[model samples]
Target: MSIQRVVAVVQDGAEPFGLGAICEVWAEPYHPDDDNPVFDFTVCTEHPGVVTGRAGFDLVVEHGLEAMADADLVCISPKHDFDHHAPAVVEAVREAHERGAWIFAHCSSSFLLGQAGLLDGRRCTTHWRYAEQLQRAFPKALVDPDVLYVEDDRIVTGAGSAAGIDAALHLLRRHFGAKVAATAARRIVVPPHRDGGQAQFVRAPVREHEAETLAPLLAWISGHLDESLTVERLARRAHMSPRTFARRFRDETGTTPLQWITNQRVALAEELLENSDLGVEQIAQRAGFGNGATLRHHFTRVRGIAPLAYRRRFTCIESA
Candidate 1:
């Protein structure tokens, strides 16, 4: 179903960043000629009164939990006390889900969905810090702590602050098409999609020395993405045996050489699609994918949309 109305549920101690992330994606108005869908966005709390945020600030919310009853999308922002959400708010979420309205939970707000019993037997995720707690609290919910977001049926759960944007964009892409989502992402000056999962954000042992050694080679590879790059070629450039380079590259970059190259090539293709008038075949060759079919194979795998479709949505042009 097309999303026309979005209601974000806020409460005492709401995280400002999480709320802002949802508002930025759904509430912001862009150019009328861009064909972007305009949503009727509302912010409501369980009680229509002054609500304090975690940052020691206050907001006077005018809408109540009932505002979410007919919303096409209902969003829940993080709160300080995940365990003790208002019964009214939980009921609002459950009702929205029952009626087939899309429900989104950002960060600790997933706990509210858990309380509402909406997450039972569903795939969900939240901030890695709270992943274990959420899983322990709701054992029946399939919680994937490694992804930036998880979408099961119509319910979406974002990992943390910025992942909210990703989840919102994902929904937009599903409802309005890639072009509309890309326009929204461009207006916000954020990438339409991100590479990898939230696992990339998790803390890992530092490889400071190895990173320092590979820094120059990494930069060189980025500049020469159009060239054929293999582990053997990179190892020769780094003055190391292929076996040693392969192991060290994984330790330093947390990904294999081929995977890193593919990501960089896809990124380059995205920039070309947004800012240039190049066709898919030319862009594919320029980004080292060899051909349009090859480019489409990797681009669709990484960005969830074809290169041509992404360009159609994001390319800036003058009207006659």
Candidate 2:
């Protein structure tokens, strides 16, 4: 559904950054940029008054739970005492979801969704630190702690900090379009896009040990994404056997060399498509796809949208 009215349900111990991130995206002031949707944003609680913040300060909330009845989107901001939830707030959340409003929970706030029974049998997540607790508390919830966020049905759950921004941007892109999301990102000085499936900062120890050893090689590979970077070719340059190089590459980068190369090529093609007026074939060759068909194949598979379509959606960024 199109999001117009957005209400954030903040309780005692609300995390400042979590609520601020929501305000940064959906509660933006008008800009000269065209086509970005402006939302009617409100902050509400179980009762309207001074809501104690998790940090040291407090926020004055003017609206009560009644504000969520007509909201298109309801955000449950993370808090310190996440398990301590107000019964009225939880009921209000369930009612909002029952009425078809999009429900988004950031970090520990997902626990509230669990209390509201919105996460049972749903693929959801919370901050990594709280994922196990959330799962243990709500055995029916499918909690995936490693991902930046998860969108199951209309419920969105994001990890802590920047991942919350990533989740909000995903919603903007899903409902409004990439251009609108990109405008919000630029205003907030964050990236325009980060896939919801991206990792949430935790890495294996093996990768940590090998990442520094391969950092220089990875930088070289990024600069030469247009070249034929076969495992054998890269192994020779790294002064190791191809088999050894392949194993080390995987451990260090968490992906195959071909996958990493293709990802970089796609990123380069995206930059050219958004910033330069180069045709598909030219961009394809420059990004090492070698042909328009190959570029279109990889681009569509990776981005879930065609190259021309993405370009059309973001072309105005050049002037913006």
Candidate 3:
């Protein structure tokens, strides 16, 4: 579906960066020669005047909730209180969903979609910290906290903060194709697509003793991601039994050693894709994926895009 008209609904305690993400992607007009689609974007609120943000600043929003009625895409920016939302805002979101307009919720705004009863029986996501609360509050929604965003039908829910950019660019990619989306991403100076899910960003609770013990091992592993790193090898390096090291690693890093190494390899591949002219086969070998096919397998699983496609969209060299 074509998304020509867009509206971002904000309220008191709304985060500026989340709201700004929407504005940056949809509202800003890029050069026409760049083949970028121009959206008729508006920022609306229930009380159209001054909306205070969590950062102790105010935004002068002139449009009211009614503006969303004509929008092809309606976005909900993160607000402070998920339990208490303005009735009009909730109703507007519900009405928009019913009318088949695309609904994009940033960060905690998924709670607003839940309040509107739109998330029921759908897969959605929010910030990892709030994922449990959202799932508990809305038992019908299948919440996947590990993803950067989730698209169930027309409703799109993004994880915390900057994932809003990922969600917005994804919608643009769907509607305008990868080339146009890449143009927009280039204008913003961000990779056209980022690899991996929110699992890499979720902060794990660190046990003091385990953290102190694993600090050196973790540092060494990060620097040598290209090497074949097994639990046995890591345990030997740390001077502990494999069983004991596995338990301690989980306690400190919240992930298995193999999984951590795979994540790091994917990160390294991402850097090489964006910065180098190397082919997928070469990148895979450099990133310790063994071959192109293996790299494609893991890269697709983690980044939701293939290695070559990601390179085409994000490669920095003009000749690439």
Candidate 4:
């Protein structure tokens, strides 16, 4: 089923990145490129306004838990004190689930689901560090520590940090399709797919040296997405061996040269589609896809819709 309304429920001491991942996935920008809908996204808390973040910053939320009443999807974002139960938040999720909203949890947020009695007899997962505790707390929960995420009975739970992105994309794929999901992934510069069962591994943080060294090259590449961006050519441009450049590229951007270029091109094509009157072939040329067919091929593969269809979505001029 297609979901258009999304409500993320947050509590005090929310984990910043965990909440950010939920917003990143559900707070979508309209790209009819895939016949995608603009989501009506809201972030609600039990007590609205000045919600404290685990990272020391505070969020000024405007809505309360009642905002979840009509949501098509409800996400429980992780908090620093996830094990601590808030009765209002728990009951809110319980009601949402009973009313047939798609329920999701990120990291220790799964514990909230357990408190709501939603995880009972449901296969779910959480961060590896908390898996055992979660299983013990909710004995009826079939918690799988080995998986990145788990979805059962309209409920989804993901491991800590960035794994939330994987679980969100999985939900997007379920509502839309692989192409639409892939397009969203590209927009965020994440790998298009990661299986739910993939082992959670340590991700190295980018060192300052890597970003500093590659800053100029990355800027240049962004500007030249319309040009041939082969790794060897880029390596030469960076004055490094192809092998060293490839490794450095990954280290800096978390993606390879080719993938980065392709993502940039797709982004450019999307922009042109939204704001330009250029024909498909012209848009393709400008975006470095070379021609309409190539643009269509990639657009269809990534966005699940053709260029013309994408353009038509934005063609109607709205009166102010």
Residue pairs in candidate 2 whose N, alpha carbon or C atoms collide under 3 angstroms: none
Sort by TM-score, top down from the best: 2, 1, 3, 4
Candidate 3 lDDT over 1-320, as tens digits, reads 57999999999998889998999999988587786778899999999999998888999999999999989999998888756799889999999888989999999999999988998999999998999999999999999887788887899999888788988887886666556767888988886764224342624454467545688888798787777888999999998999998887766655677777887788688777777788888888889899989999998886668877777765544322
Question: Per-residue lDDT of 1-320 in model 2, one digit per residue for the tens?
Answer: 78899999998888999999988887887777645677899999987899999789999999999999999999998888999798998999999999899999988899999999999999998888889999999999999987788988889999988899999998886676655777788878897766665567633353455434777798898898788889999999888899988887766555668877887798788778877888899899899999999999999987668888888776753321
TM-score-best of 1 and 3: 1
Where in model 2 is the C-alpha error above 4 Å?
33-36, 202-320
Q: Give one digit per residue, the lDDT tens place, for model 4 in 1-320.
A: 45888999998998999989998988977876655557999999988879999887999999999999999999999999989968998999999989889999999999999999998889999999999999999999999997778888789999989899999997886566555777888888997766676656523464567544787887888788778878889999899999988887766555667766776687677667766677777778888888888888887766556766656654542211
User: Which candidate has the top score in TM-score?
Assistant: 2
Q: What TM-score does each of the candidates earn?
A: 0.74, 0.76, 0.66, 0.64
Judged by lDDT relative to the true structure, which candidate is superior, 1 or 2?
A: 2
Sorted on lDDT, highest at the top, how do the candidates line up?
Answer: 2, 1, 3, 4
The residue ranges of model 1 lying beyond 4 angstroms of the native Cα positions read: 32-36, 177-179, 196-320
TM-score of 4: 0.64
Task: Please write out the lDDT profile of model 1 over residues 1-320, one tens digit for every residue.
Answer: 66899999999998899899999888877467666777999999988999998898888899998899899999998888877799989998999999989999998899999999988999999988999999999999999887778888799899887878988887886676556677788887887765434343633456568544688899899899999998999999998999999977877665678988998898788777767778888889899999989999999987778777776665563211
In model 4, the clashing pairs are: none
Off by over 4 Å in 3: 195-320
Clashes of 3: 0
Candidate with more favorable, higher lDDT: 3 or 4: 3
The models' CA-based lDDT, in order, is 0.83, 0.85, 0.83, 0.82
